[model samples]
Target: MANVIRRAEERDAASLQHLQAATPGMPEWTQVHWLGLLSGDAIVVIAETDGEVAGYAVASLLRIPGEVVAELEAIVVTPSHRRNGLGNGLLRYLLAEAQAAGAIRLMLEVRTGNGAARALYQGLGFQEEGLRRRYYRDPVEDAVLMSLQFPQEAVAVEKGQE
Candidate 1:
């Protein structure tokens, strides 16, 4: 099936909500919350296969003391769509978007037990940095923090690096 990845629109809120409901451990966001995300500063993208919303990913730019960092807020693919590279496509698109938006790094936290997700992040160059104790509550799982750093050539040049 042909897959299309694009920026999410307000019209996608319902589909997103449905996807969220179908996925366990995903944040239970109301349609209004999803709509707010589409209209807010968050970067949200969806993958459509055969005109159906197969998956989506969300990230937000965070202003740190001296630089901006992108955080992967959530990513979910319908159960039937898993293992088809839709998640990878959504994340790759988010990575490019975050870098283009001047973020120096992208960060995320995943449940320690989520091997599939951990593998996906590692395959994409996100390194494990640390862990948070009891970060998820449904079954009280720890969260493994991961990050992907973007090359800061511009910043280095500005700091007088050749």
Candidate 2:
């Protein structure tokens, strides 16, 4: 599909809120929250085609003394746009940005019933690290904690020293 993925803007808040509402199991974020994130520390991107939003991804970083940890807050694609690689594209964008920002690892939690999302994460090199019981409401499901660790050796390879 001819979709463009770009940094989200304040004007995207309302549309994103609507999309989040239509997506089951997604946290309902207020327009104010979305607007605040536009200027906040999170890395947020949206995919659009024909001026219509197709998907979006949000990620935030936590800095430690020697390393950066990134959390994938959310990734959502409209039902009509599912299976077209929009979600994959959004996630790949976050992964690249986080790595460039010095993130040593990426983390996220998904409801156990979300097989599709879990599969996507695994396909992208995430592994199940732990589980939180009853971490998701509405249906009260377990949350599978997943993480992807970037190898420090990659720096040497990128620097042409390997």
Q: Write the per-residue lDDT of candidate 2 for residues 1-162, one digit (tens) a residue.
A: 579988898989999999889898787899999988877878888999778999899998898896688999999898899998888989988887777777788999999998999999999999999999999888999999999998877644544547
Worst 10 residues of 1 by lDDT: 153-162
Question: Could you say which candidate leads in lDDT?
Answer: 1
Error of 2 at 71 (Å): 0.6
Clashes of each: 0, 0
| Model 1 error, position 40 (Å) | 1.3
The TM-score of predicted model 2 comes to 0.89
Clashing pairs in 2: none
Error of 2 at 144 (Å): 0.9
Worst lDDT 10-window in candidate 2: 152-161
Relative to the true structure, how large is the alpha-carbon lDDT of every model? 0.92, 0.88
